[model samples]
Target: MTPSVPSSSRRARRRTAAVGVLVAAAVTAAFALTLDDSAHRDDTPDPSAVVTGSAAPPPADDSLLALARRDPSDALAVGRADAPVVMIEYSDFQCPFCRQFAQNTEPELLRSYVDRGVLRIEWRNFPVFGEESEQAALAGWAAGQQGRFWEFHDVAYGEPRERNAGEFSEEKLTGMAREAGITDIGRFQADMASDKARSAVREDQEEGFRLGVTSTPAFLINGRPVLGAQPVATFTEAVETAAKAAKAAGR
Candidate 1:
């Protein structure tokens, strides 16, 4: 039998893994902090390149990847083909706060908008860490190709450090798709590896940069940008504002 790592050692490993993601996610987030912290990177030139290895996602150093690697369900959906409003998320897997939002916050939004038919949700991958983050996003996208984007996205952030762990691995994503009820895994895998899917992920990141989204959980509602893990009220207000604007435009 394998001995469990000491709690302290395990925590140390998680914190160490989290460090690289913090730097990458913080690259855009520093602006929201004090002036000293605000000295971080902003306005990236090309987001797709970053997510695709120009910068690469971070390595598996934390538990978020482990959490993300678990088999995900096929309960979530991306984009609002039927929604009057669109909500886009700029996210990184290793960010603990994103995980919290996924667990505590997103559920409410789903009950209200995602299910209520008021809005559409779009998952935009912004892997800032290095290879691990990118790997995780790719896995989730693969799940999306299998028509399980939300299930994969939901479970991913729940992971404390499974950025590129077992289930989240490229090869393992197919199994996750099957678990998520996907019947055509081969087709899904092919789609995920296609340039169109890659372009979709990249376009999202590029648009996020254009909209000043430098952090995980930033939202673009009906074409407007809202940054950070804002409160539910903030999201409500933004949605209402966008809705009202769209209504006035007769859209």
Candidate 2:
């Protein structure tokens, strides 16, 4: 499945090529009377052709989070030792829809949960594409090394989809990291080549397969799974349920 288009790119920059015309006919030798007729032609394509497919069913996000914590070396989970709940997200950087989900739907989540320190968000890097994808995920994790993971992920996904070939070249990756406020660029580059970064990509892909997450932007809140670029309301409900469950378990 294609990544969700980011709200900014889709809503602001998309262009329409339709034309508008105005015509007038004059009648008279010295001073002619005028007739006015204006018409606009409609050629917009039907949305139903692409929009008719059955929506992919939503999965449980809580169970999925639990399933992801199996490997102690998972990239994002290592540092968040005291969080009440962990959030595991399977994401691709090139997906436009993933960009949309990050830019629009994720703000409220970050503000209330992550910023408040109630939930820890861990990024899992599963690159669906070839080199560009894998490289992008690695660079993103490298950005995380300098405390810029969220910034890099959010910004990269929103950038124009790169040329597929050579998209994740070292120059490109470092450039993107620099743009996302990652200082100490030398360390970031080294991290990209280390076993740490490559393992993150491979492990994410493996866990995704085991959990049937065959697509980008799959999410695991607590131990359950929610796939695709879902609405914000969906995530809110899942998080609330997870919090309640944790509370009940402690009791």
Which candidate has the highest lDDT of all? Answer: 2
Task: Residues 4-116, candidate 2: write the lDDT tens digits.
Answer: 86786555444321111110010011011111111001112121211111333343333234453533444454334456667777777765445656776777888877677
Alpha carbon lDDT of each predicted model = 0.57, 0.61
TM-score of 2: 0.68
What's the lDDT of the predicted structure labeled candidate 1?
0.57
Cα RMSD, each candidate: 19.6, 20.8
Looking at model 1, residue 129 earns an lDDT score of: 55
Model 2 CA lDDT for position 229 = 55
Tell me the TM-score of each prediction against the true structure: 0.61, 0.68
Per-residue error for 146 in candidate 2, Å, reads 2.5
| C-alpha lDDT of residue 159 in model 1 | 42
After TM-score superposition, the amount by which residue 232's alpha carbon in candidate 2 deviates from its true location, in angstroms, is 0.6
